[model samples]
Target: MPMHPIEVDDDVYALLQQHARPFVDQENDVLRRLLGLDGSPTAVANRVSGGDLRALIDAKLLAPGDELVHIQTRKGLTHRAVVTADGNIRLPDGSTYAKPSPALKACVGHDINGWGQWIHAQSRESLQSLREALRERQAD
Candidate 1:
């Protein structure tokens, strides 16, 4: 097999190292596992629904009842959602969505990166930013 050199910043390199399996000697192997290409095709998406947000709650990345707001730039209406006790998301009108994007679409009437658009009430940052912070902490 041939090897290719890819450039990564310090943070990404740290993330790869943090996720590298202990017994993996090759960088490719480590990267494969980190990327969930080591045989689990649905691993990344599955982990998103289960582990990622759960870990955030466990690590206190977000608190229950934390409001997630999306401001519709065109409509000029602010949509609000709350994180439930069980980590499910509930929209302003009492409708619930398991994922953020749908909830955001329901709120704002458009498709968007809910993770990037939904602002965390406390942190005043996007959910995407918060998730990145959680991943960064794991890397450390």
Candidate 2:
């Protein structure tokens, strides 16, 4: 086995960090995954999809400790949570969800797109809108 050093911009580094688990995932593993190579014998990673709110933290659009609320459209119910320091969603019941979807499921007791469901408490911006804005920025 050989090792080499490479340089990437901060954003790319952030993406790599997001995928790399400390003491569990390595840089080579991250790179291999990015290149569509299977470096592990285990099943595929359980990665959260496009609506993942962690991206907001990475992009600095949202910060640790920021408040978010999910307003269930049909039930007219509201659930509140905060972003933990490590970028996980922390609900009032003291459970942490790695992504917004499951947290939302816990809230509404049903399946829903968390991005569209979760709104920033301060900005009132939906996670989907934030994602779209990020995409637009990248496209520009």
Candidate 3:
């Protein structure tokens, strides 16, 4: 899709960022969602609900209530989220994300490799490491 650029002042830009779903939502997506132009609310819900966390949960790599932390050292920011029983990620803002990438995006306002960025709080391991272990185990 071709994207067009538009300018907004800091406040308006911050507002747009506040309503965005991180990596999942571009500015247009947020505007569309807010204006009810993104189809049925059910469709919006479905879009946010599908994620990769369930595979980790099923493989016993992560448990419900586990905390994940993302630290942007250069930016001096640290964001945290918890794993839900259903394998969704629950952000501090009380929003649940089905995947780590969008969850991390919600924190940093851009895309980053979530599997590498989110640290398993207890283990101090990256989600990427856990995923690799799971893959290795499955291949065995």
Candidate 4:
């Protein structure tokens, strides 16, 4: 891949810095679409519309997954599991979550890096069912 020098304005540069992951994600999506990997919004649109090659050149940005972890906090007093979307764990009680470091492991016998590693849950509803319910209500 050849690198091109395209100068962006200050605002765009700030946006790029602020939303770096999304920009990178959009690029990855474009490449994946070209390779026929499905599931992106643009890829779905391209498949349906036929003449729109926008998905080929387009970039779709989205938020990253949660930063999940199991944490032990405050003088070996309490332990509860939680997942963070942005690595933030500051509670109203003035405590913050930390990844299980060696010191934490020393305090507690067992150590775990993440809660989402062992903690999993799922949503029960689908788009079709939800849409059908909405349509029925609207008809009524």
- Residue 87 lDDT in candidate 1: 58
lDDT of 3 by residue, 48-97 (tens): 55347778888888888999999888989889999876666777654666
The CA lDDT at 60 in model 4 is 17
| Angstrom error at residue 50, model 4 | 12
lDDT for 102 (candidate 2): 82
Top TM-score model: 3
Return the candidate ranking by TM-score, descending.
3, 1, 2, 4
Best by lDDT: 3
Q: Write the per-residue lDDT of candidate 1 for residues 1-140, one digit (tens) a residue.
A: 58899888999776666655557445676666544455553344434564234556778988878888877788787888888655557654444555677768776677877888989888899988988998899899
- List TM-score per model, in order: 0.60, 0.58, 0.64, 0.25
Query: How much lDDT does each candidate structure score?
Result: 0.69, 0.71, 0.79, 0.33
Name the better of 2 and 3 by TM-score.
3
| Per-residue accuracy of model 2 over 38-114 as CA lDDT, tens digit each | 43221122232322456677888888889999876787878999876555676665445667788788788889888
Model 2 residue runs over 4 Å out of place are 1-51, 73-76
- lDDT at 57 for candidate 2? 75
Model 4 has an lDDT value of: 0.33
- Model 4, 1-140: lDDT tens per residue? 57555676897555444433453445333334333343645335434453211221121111123121233445545433222232222222222232323222433456733322222112222222333444566579
lDDT of 3: 0.79
Error of 3 at 69 (Å): 0.4
Candidate 3 has which clashing residue pairs, if any? none
